[model samples]
Target: MNWILLIIAGLFEVGFATCLGKAKEATGNSALFWMIGFFVCLSISMFLLYRATLTLPIGTAYAVWTGIGAVGTVLVGVFIFKEPATFWRIFFLTTLIGSIAGLKFVSN
Candidate 1:
């Protein structure tokens, strides 16, 4: 379904973001590889987002896509990058998830 594709696209958005973070930490060949990963993920994410927009409302799809990316990237930061998962961060994340789900529920 398009919604599924939208979710996958959102996940790829997270992939690109993670790649950027890794690329920043890397050097030389490693950094180049990470950048390559970033571009590849970016391409796939964009393509799938376009595809999902065929049937889904653009506003809802975009919001859900960015919401997924934001939630995923934040979790990645907390777990992989060891970034602090403060109370406010977690609270907002939960609200974002609820909003995304609500969009899906309300959409056609």
Candidate 2:
């Protein structure tokens, strides 16, 4: 259950990051809304991360959380922002995802 929360938190991390990017590109009232979303998502992500740390090893939780966020963010960038999805980038992202899964599998 904790791991599940952690994963959801990681997804929220991706949400916040994407919101930040949109906020950066936005103007006037649009930027305000995106900024609000960024803060809300960030708060939820951090809170869930902290909650997971109560039961899970902090180091493992944090690493996995960040790994999920990083990979998810890269995917969102490629698909939504039309960022380059070069072979090497996809390869590295896949490697990171594998590492994240390995961590989850090895954790107590």
Candidate 3:
């Protein structure tokens, strides 16, 4: 389904974001490797987003896509990158999750 593709695309968005973070922390060949991964993930994410948009409403799809990416990237930051998980961050994350789920339920 297009929604599934959109979700997958959102995941790839997370992958690219993670790769960027890793690339930033890396040097020499390691940085190059992560950069390559970033480009690959970016390409796949864009392709899936394009495919999903063929049927899904653009506004809804884009919002959901970015929502998923934002949520996933934040979690990744907290877990993988050792970023602080403050109270406000968690509170807003919960709301964002609710919004994403609400969009899914309200959408066709």
Q: Global CA lDDT of candidate 2, please?
A: 0.96
Worst 10 residues of 1 by lDDT: 99-108
TM-score of candidate 1 to 2 decimals: 0.99
* Deviation from native of the Cα of residue 108 in model 1, angstroms: 0.4
Against the true structure, what is every candidate's RMSD? 0.4, 0.5, 0.5
Model 1 residue runs over 4 Å out of place are none
After best superposition, candidate 3 residue 1: deviation in angstroms?
0.7
Task: Tell me the tens digit of each residue's lDDT in model 1 across 1-108.
Answer: 999999999999999999999999999999999999999999999999999999999999999999999999999999999999999999999999999999999999
The all-Cα superposition gives candidate 3 an RMSD in Å to the true structure of 0.5
- What C-alpha root-mean-square deviation, in Å, does candidate 1 show against the real structure? 0.4
TM-score of 3: 0.98
Predictions in order: lDDT:
0.99, 0.96, 0.97
Residue 39's C-alpha lDDT in candidate 1?
100
**Model 3: per-residue lDDT, tens digit, 1-108?**
999999999999999999999999999999999999999999999999999999988988999999999999999999999999999999999999999999989988
Ranking of models by lDDT: 1, 3, 2
